[model samples]
Target chain A: MASDDSVSLRVTPLFSLCQELGARFTPFAGYRMALSFPAGTLREHQHTREAASLFDVSHMGQIVVSGPDRVALLESLTPASIRALPPGRLRYSMFTTPTGGVLDDLMIACRGDDLMVVVNAARREADLAHLREAARGHAADVALLEDQALLALQGPAAAAVLSALAAGVGDLPFLGMGPFALDGVLCWVSRSGYTGEDGFEISVKATHVEPLARRLLADPRVAPAGLAARDTLRLEAGLCLNGADLTPSITPVEAGLGWVVGRERRLDGQFPGSDVLFQQLAEGPAWCRVGLRLAGRAVARPGAPVLDPQGAEVGVVTSGGFSPTLNQPIAMARVPAALASPGQPLAVRVRDHQLDALVTALPFVPARTVGRACSGPSEPRNKP
Target chain B: MSKVYYTEDHEWIRVEDGKEGTVGITDFAQAQMGDVVFVELPPVGTVLTQGEQAAVVESVKAASELYAPVSGTVVAVNPDLPDAPGTVNEDPQGEGWFFRLALTQPNELADLMDQDAYEVFVAEAGESAG
Candidate 1:
C-alpha cells in the first residue's frame, strides 16, 4: 500500500469547510479528500438516499474541447457518437486503447461549439496526454479548467433544494447541462451524478465553491457526504469505479459498458479497439462483470478470489462492500461469461472461508434518478 | 471489578476470575475504523494463540484482522453481531464484546498493557498517523 508521504497531496478549495464539518481526510488520487464526516459512512449513505447531500468532486479532471472539428477529434479517441450528441446533453463514454482495453471512462457534455469532459482524477494526466496525442493534426484544442471546483448535490430531494436556490434549475432534464447562476455565482450545472440519484453537478470558480458549498449545506435537507458514502452509493447503484471495475486490460464489452459504444461506430469499426470490441459484442466476452449477493454479512472486498461451484477460482471481485440501503453485503465481480447469469450460484473467498453467494442482477437498489416519475410504491420490494 | 488489558493491535480483554475473559476491540480501534458493518468470529472451542488472527471486522471502507491478545480457547461468541454489527461502533468496550475465551495461559496477561499504558500507546500511534 502506498503511504500519504509517497505523493504530494493537494486539497480542494472546500478543504477548510470539510474540516469545519468534521470530515476525516483520506488520500485519494494524490489529494487529501474527505473520506467521511462525523455522521459516519452508514448514516451518510442513508442520508443521501433519503435527502440531499453535497460532495466536493473538484479532484476530477475537467477539460473543454473546442473548435470546428471537436466532435471528430473526440470521436477518434472514444467510441461514443460524439457528432450526434445534441447541445446540453451528457453522454458517458470511455477512451479505448488500441488493443480493446479501457483507458478511462468519462462524461462528455456538448456545449454548442465546445465539449466539456470530466475524467477520473487518478487518470487525469494520462487522459489528457491520450487526448493530445489523438488530437494531433486535428483542428481541436483541449484546455484544462484548473481553477474550477466541482460540487455534486445528490439525492431524491436535490431538485427541490437546487430549484430553491436557482429558479430555472429544475427545468434541466436528466443528463442535461447548461449555464446557471447560484446566488449570482456563474456555474455550469449538469443534472447528472454518479450515485444514480436525482441530482446536479455544478462547476464554478474555485473561489466561489466554498460559499456555494456552505450555502447548500445550510439547507436542512442537504448534508455533507464524503468519498466513503460516494463509493457505496455508486456500488449499490451498479455504477463501476474507474480503476476497480475498469482497467487498461478490460474492454468495454467485458465490463458491461457496451451500451456506450454507438451502433454506427460498432459497425464502422472506426474507434480505437473497435475490432476487438465488435468481436466481443458479436461472439460474447470471455469474462463479464456481474453482481454478487453474498449469503452472509461478510463482505468480499476487492481482489477477493471468486470461486466456481467446484471451488476453483474463476475470477476476481473488483469491488465489494456492505450496502447500507440493502443492509447486506453486495459485490461486483468479473466471472466467466457463461456463469454470469442472474441466479447462478458462486462463492466468494472472505478470509479463510468461502462464503455462499449468488450471481444477481446489477443495481442492488433501484435508482431514483430524476425525469422518471415516481409512479410506483415508494418502498422497495425485494428485501436483501 | 475485573481488570482490563490491551494489545498493541488495539484489542481489549477484560479478565474475570483469572480464567474467563471477554474480548473486543478498543474504542480507539472502532473510532479509527469509521463503521463496523460485519464481524466474523471464531467458533466456540477454537484455539487461539496470542497475536494470531482470531477474527475479522469489516467496514464499508476496508476489512481488518482482529488478533487475539492472549492464548485461549473460544468459549462463546457474540450472537448479536450478525444482526447488529453497529454495536461495535456504538459501544465497543461494552455490549460489543466479540467473544469470551477460556485462558490457556493466564501468565500471558502480564505482558499486555493496562489502561494508562494503552492510552499512552494510542496517543503515540495517533500522532504518527496524523
Candidate 2:
C-alpha cells in the first residue's frame, strides 16, 4: 500500500539471483519479493532448521542517525533507553503513539558515535519521514542508507557457513555488531536475526550483496530462502509480524512486548504513550497476546474469531498458519488476560466450523539464539 | 485407461465407465499448491452435486477446496490421504485420488475440458495470473 496503485513494484538487489534459483515472485510491501523457490516454502523452512538459509532482506529500511543529540532525540520519541545502550549491541524497540498504540517495531544498534536503525519495509517511507521531521532543528541528522542491502543468514549452521567465509564472525556475541570482511569485502555484520536461530544480519553495499549472497549459496550447507519461509520460521518461533500482529491500535503490553520498553525508563519514561504503557504494565492489560495450538489440520487464518468454551466470541486471531516445524496448525491471538495461560481452552472459527484450540506457551519451537554464541527466530529470549 | 476431464478450478475426473469416475486435483494444481500438509475428505456414500465443495486440501501456506466435478455419489475416498496428504504432491493424478463417483448426471462431463483444451485453459489462465 505504500506505493501508488499505478506505480510499478521495485525489485531488490538479489532479484536476478533469486530468479536464477527459480524463485516465484510475489508483490510484498511494494517490492517484488521472492515468495518461494523450486523446493517450496515448506521445504526451505525445514532446510533452515537443519542447515543455513540466506534471506535477502533488502526491502527493510536502514537509517543512520548521527550527532551529539541523536540519542536524546530518539529516546524522546520511544520507550528505549538509548543513553544506556553500549556501543556495538542491538536493542529491539518500537515507535509508539501518544495513546500507547504501536507505529512500528525496529532494531536499534549502538554503533559508537552513531546509531543504526532497521525498520520494517512496509513502514519505511513513514518511518523515514517521521525520523527526518522529528530531528528538525536538533543536532541529530537522519539519513537513509539507500545503497545498502541487508541479508540474513539464519539457522543452526549459519555461524559455520559464515565463519568459513569470514574468520572471527562466529565469535561476535548475540545482538552485537561490528566490521567483518566476507571474502575480503568489508561489511557490517550483526549477530541478530528474526528467525530464532544463531545467525547474522549482514549489511553490505548493494553492489556487493549479490556476489556475497552467491558466495554463501555456494556452500553445501547454505541455500537461498524466500519470504514465505521467513514468515513461517518467525511464526513458529512466536515472533510477531509487523502488519499482522503489531499495529497502530496494539500496545506493547497487550502485544506481549513489555520488555521491549526499557526497564530502566519505567519510572521516568518520557516517550509517547509512556504513561499509558507503564499503567498497563502495572495493572496488566485487559487483552493479551497468546499462542494457540489448533486441534485439527485446518489452518486458523488471521482475523478468525476466537471463541470461549461457552461459544462466545472472546478475542481475535492476529497471526495464524500451518507451522511446518511443528507440522500442525498454530496461531497467535489477542484474548482476555484471564484466558492468556498455558493450556487454556479456546476455539477458533475458521470458515464455518469451530476448531478446538489450546493456549500454548509461545515459541512453539525452542529458540536457539547465541547469548555470547548462536540461536533461532525467537520469543524475545523470554525462555518460555 | 479412462478419458480424463478437467475443471477451471483445477480438479480432474477420470471416467473408465460412463458412471464410474475417479476424482483428484490436477498435477498443475498440486504443483501450484506447494507441499501438502493435511487433507479433509467427505465420507464414503456422500452425495455431491456438480461444482459442490466436496473436499479440502491444506498446504503449508493455504487451504484449497476440491469441488465435485460432476454430480455423483461418493462410493469411495483414498483412505491414505488424511494421514499422509503429501502423497498428493508426489502422485496427484494417480495414488493421490480423492474420491470415486457413481455419477448421477454423467452428462455434466460434456461441459468440462479435455486434456488438450485444459492445457490451453491452464496456459492462458497462468499467463493472465502471472
Docking quality of model 1: it rates as medium
Model 2 C-alpha lDDT per residue in residues A186-295, reported as the tens digit of each score: 99999999888888999999999999998899999998898888988889988888877888888878888887777678868888999998888888888888999999
In candidate 1, which residue ranges exceed 4 Å CA deviation?
Answer: A1-3, A372-384
Error of 2 at B105 (Å): 2.5
lDDT leader: 1
Q: Supply the TM-score of chain A against the true chain A for every candidate structure.
A: 0.95, 0.95
Clashing pairs in 1: none
lDDT by residue (tens digit), candidate 2, B11-46: 999998797999999988887778888888899999
Clash count per candidate: 0, 14
The superposed Cα distance between candidate 1 and the true structure at residue A206, in angstroms, equals 0.7
Interface RMSD of predicted model 1: 2.9
Q: What i-RMS does every model get?
A: 2.9, 6.2
